[model samples]
Target: MADLNTQHMIDEIRDNIQTGDTLKTKLVLAHLPDVDMKTQNRLIYELSRGDVRFTVPILLYLMTEHVSIVDELPVIKETLLSNLLAYPELLIEFLSDTSIKDKTHLINVAGELRFEEAVPALLYLVANSQDEPEIKLIIETLGLIGDPQAINTLTDYLYAANRDLIITAIQALGQVGTQSAMHRLAERMGTDNEMDYMILSIFADVQDPVSLEKLNDTLASHYAHMRIYAKQELVRIGAKAVPALIDNLLQDDPDFVIHTLNVLGDIGDESAIMPIRKLLGKDPKSANVRFAAYEALALLPLRKGAYTLTAGLTDPEDHVCVAAAKAIDQNYSEILTAGIKNLLRPKGDEARHIAKIIVSAQVDKIFLSLAAEDFFQELSLVYLPHAHKDTKEHYTRLLVKHGFDEFANKIQGGEDVKNLVKVVAVDDSRMILNIYKATLHELGFEPVLFEFPASAIEWLQNEKPAMVLTDLNMPEITGVMMAAEIRKKYSPKELPIIMVTTQNETNDNEAAYAAGVNKVIQKPFNAKSLKAAMDEFM
Candidate 1:
């Protein structure tokens, strides 16, 4: 038997639900805990058949409060999903309700039930809602439903004026993971650096050949940040990315080869070792390729990796030699006993130079001390003649400390060296070019000015500037096209490029980025903003 208050509350809920009084119905439903199980079931059954204006809230309340009426009554759960599916018009009405909390609950219910019939209504809410929270929930629900019809609408949201909406839509599309969704995401790659990692994560989930190719192309993107994201995504894909990476390695592009080697090294799989070794053996002239391969081999546990790294110590490039030495020091410590002595033996000037670098990096104190003495002796003989006054003095102190007073007496000094970073600025407007020149000079950079985009490209072919800045709307060659051409020869890490544009159009910005523009600076930018952009890439 129900208590008097509990029976009165159930009677009030029954009467309000029949009369379509939503507030009174909610008031009574709120006290459902006071009712007995039999009365709660009767109240739920009666409410399920009433107007959705009355029933939707009751269902939401029951679901939210963990009311036993929903769990103990199968008819209540079925009626909730059926009413939402049976009356899509009511969902539209609820979606249009002034209360955001109500709309969010309704969207969640529709999504939880995967009511495909309600997708149109959900999309309508997404299209019209100005509230970011409401829009985010609607977009997420549509994705949870995983309907193919939502792809185009979700893709449009990818360019929403609000960034959070764009990010939510991206995550939703990734959940959709449909072929169309993935293709749309791939098409939008490189549009924004901030969004690249999220988009690459989506692509990795796709795990198809097209996605693999896009990930591979990004490995050579003109933005170091994008390249890093691509590499991380590739490694996250793990063995899934290995075959495609290997296929790309067969290409003649040195940039592709180097990036693939790096990705393989990051993956740290032994399967890639043979292909990388073969490429290294074939491309002896490419010091970059050899360096990447040696680094990749060092990441593996193979015994041959130690010998390959040791051979890298003899390479003429200082960076390669240093990398090899560091790898030997860190990963191949056992190689130090025989390898360090073999490297130290007098072979040639380059060999001796590399040997000194290796011994200095060794962990063994005896080897390090002996190697330091030999290195200082060689340095005194090589640099004492042309050393600056301060450098000569510093070397004299070093030589004296090592008991080489004779060499210390011969020390002389020269002027200090200053290395200035070079930047190229191109704009059709002489006024903007002057601003660029003045600003760059004040920032301690040497600026090369070009009024013509063609001439800028020509100069870039001969002299490699640290970074390039160009206006978007050029006369003969647009900044984007010039950037594309430049990217053909130099990777983003090798040469970074930024575009300045008065065009606020999304298409123009997207086109510019697609053409390898690393960053975009809008018109009327000040020295502060320009310096900030330059600093980001430099």
Candidate 2:
């Protein structure tokens, strides 16, 4: 207590804290550790009550340049963070001070505070810093700050070869959560599944109309799992997704329309019914879309015009006709039955066509809906005996199961597909598989269909059919993926694979051919196109 040098230094530090002089304060803080604990604590308390601006920088200086001072006063660093956050302008000044080299701790403070004012300094650090962890911290701080200015820099990091940087930048952009930030995220899709899925989830969280549109656009992505993930998110978005999805129908892209229809159907929003009906009325050229529409209609409740569904019974494509029959059975109408009755009265091609529709639609609801009609039942009996055994047995059992034992007994069992050359086809959509069944049979080949790629691959191990037709966008193992597996056991010369897809992009075509496909054909395929492609390998 009587030491002159130490007592004089403590007096100088006290005067510096009271005077709010930065240079004088740093000079005095340099001697702070030399004082006793009681004197240091008293000086720090005075420093805390000093000018806020002077207190922050003086504390930063002591912490950065005087490690012993910080060790002697442990609360000094936490106090520095507290003051910097409490007065963000001071945080910005401290952050912008490049002369104080180690700013990782301060950059974290800026991020944690989401200090928007600190963005410029953070950006400066981002541009100047070579340290990855520090740069990552700056990127995160900018995102947390959510200034529009940071988007360009954040997007630049998206292209970085470092996966961690790319991932961190993606997350930061997600935190920014602006329309521009989400747009930047969307642009990074298709680099890979993990990133694509990450972007999708971000869009889901943001859930703006723009994000919804971007999510809708992913339906057209060449990758199947991405498309699947997009659909799941859209479905999860529910009725809120209806307007944009309805707009998707107006676009000429039928593949996009088909996916939108699938999501809309899963959502089952009643408002979507009219838009869907309007799409159907436009007579979309894609049978896949038509099948999807009727499939959706089967799930939706019909309010007024259930009778209009009977028109599908006469659609030239068996797939469309069958889907219509399923929709009709779900919303059973005497009016629809009568409309179908009038169509069947000629009891010739139309009568036989309705019978085939009921049998192939395969639900007992549609079958029983028309079973009481003499002409229809009699006509179905004629074709039921000759229909594919699976179709026949399916109807027979469902008929018996639903208490239509009499009609079940009347369907003479089974048509032998054994005589036809077996052609393997894989598509996730049951509607598409049914189309393959009828189309392949007409070409004098038996169709063995798989609704999953895994099952198709497992079957390909033991059973190599004449040729395989697989949809390009099946879940998990895409058409290209399945083609690669099949190529392992069988050469293109040994077995031809045709990639059936709604989207005919050059990248997908190139990838499919690289995976050992014999041909890549676009969908809404007909007997003519299907046969033309099939005959090449035959």
Candidate 3:
């Protein structure tokens, strides 16, 4: 396929390369663009098979000697690159060569080869270079090499003045995936949320022992989004995180145990079932702890000890009782059914309270088992009208499932909320929203309840509600976070936000206050406390 001029040019270039003729090499390469593309490719094809131990240096020299020439004969650069990859040791040697000023491609090839031997050369470029893009590429190449020797240099960049550099170093260290590398990453958790979340993601993907330990430790963090991210990652980790979570149950900290229980419950591993039950046997008095434990048990199949769930009907807190009831509903047995029936049979205050729990829990089988009871019917009708819309639909489905269409229709016809004072309440829990539905209605205001805070936030942008009630520790956005967004439009006097927190730590109160919360009320709030907290702001 070689034409006369192209073959002559290739022969001249080969002759120049063999004779070590520098000026002639440059002269021959300069004529590359003057010829047709076929001629240029032919020259490259011939040079690719040439003796590159001497020939490559001449090409490198030409590359150094040129702006006009390299742009004119770009194929010379391509030919050099092809040979560099073809001979990898030569690629590493070229990477180490201080004479080759444009070693960007060389560094990239070393990384593609994952040549650990090239780290010192790459580090030398990192130390000498200040250009962000070139240094970033070099750092990334170091990460692809994943050599431990680069860890210290990468660690230094974690606190770089440039955020992009910081992000790059984090990714690089994550790719390193050594124990010390993970420890360095774990040390950066409190830097800021964006960085912390990125680092946590690395830990999650790395899944080494140190990374797992760091993730486990983050469960106890106070920041809602951070803790939520950790809980999600741990549950995603599932069985691998079980041993650590199970060990967490023995710890003295209630908040720590509660968070661990929440993750384990979502993980739904059977091995955790007995350990959790044993944990419950210690008579953990924190209602939040009991609620988390039972919530977790509801997700796991507790085949042997399911009847024990009915005992939670006697829990001092309504939420925990609901948790226990749901757990019993999921692992339903005749013995558990009889246990629940006996617990609600007396029809006294105790029976009324337990029936409310069962209704709120919304277990189809348990609700159906007691559907014919007059006491259950009376309480169900009373609460059904004001229950959250979804809860109402859920029970309506249950009622129709068992030939109680008339009763279902009755609750479905509950009072209209369109005309009442529109007070918006944002919480992720349907159970809590149901409580808001009844409590806010009783307090003489129509409750616009959202099981999703984002939906509530979107609704608030157009219409101004009388007030907004939010809860901390939601999945994507916390109550404090939502309050901050609302405060951007309406001030404390213009629009009031009442932050409902399960934990009453002073620092959390400060965060809510700083986020423009009008009042901070500790949960489990009732109509009385909620109205009192709202009274001051109103």
Which regions of candidate 1 deviate over 4 angstroms? 1-54, 57-103, 124-133, 204-211, 251-256, 284-286, 303-313, 322-354, 361-538
Writing each residue's lDDT as its tens digit, candidate 3 over 395-465 gives 88878988988778888767655677778888776656766766787687878988777888788788898
Deviation from native of the Cα of residue 9 in model 3, angstroms: 4.7
Candidate 1 CA-lDDT value:
0.70
For model 1 the local lDDT of residue 396 reads 60
Instruction: Please give, for residues 1-538, the per-residue lDDT of candidate 2 as tens digits.
Output: 3453755666777787776667877776676766677777766776787777677767777777888778868878778877776777777777777667788678888878877877877888888888998888788788788888888999999999889899999998988888988988888888787999999999988898779889988888777778888999989889888888888888887778888888888899998889888888888777778988998998899988888888788787777887888788789877876787788768898778777667666756656667667777778888687767777778778778777788888886644657678899999878778878767766778889999999989988998799999988766688988999999999999999999887777778888999999999877677798999989999
User: Given candidate 1, what's the lDDT at residue 425?
Assistant: 93
lDDT at 510, model 2: 89
Name the lDDT of candidate 3. 0.81
Between prediction 2 and prediction 3, the one with superior TM-score is 3
User: Would you list the clashing residue pairs of candidate 1?
Assistant: 388-413, 388-414, 389-413, 389-414
Q: Estimate each model's TM-score.
A: 0.53, 0.80, 0.88
Which TM-score value belongs to model 2? 0.80
lDDT of 3 at 523: 65
Candidate 3: worst 10 consecutive residues by lDDT? 1-10
Off by more than 4 A, model 2: 1-88, 158-166, 185-197, 220-229, 401-406, 413-423, 437-448, 458-466, 525-532, 535-538
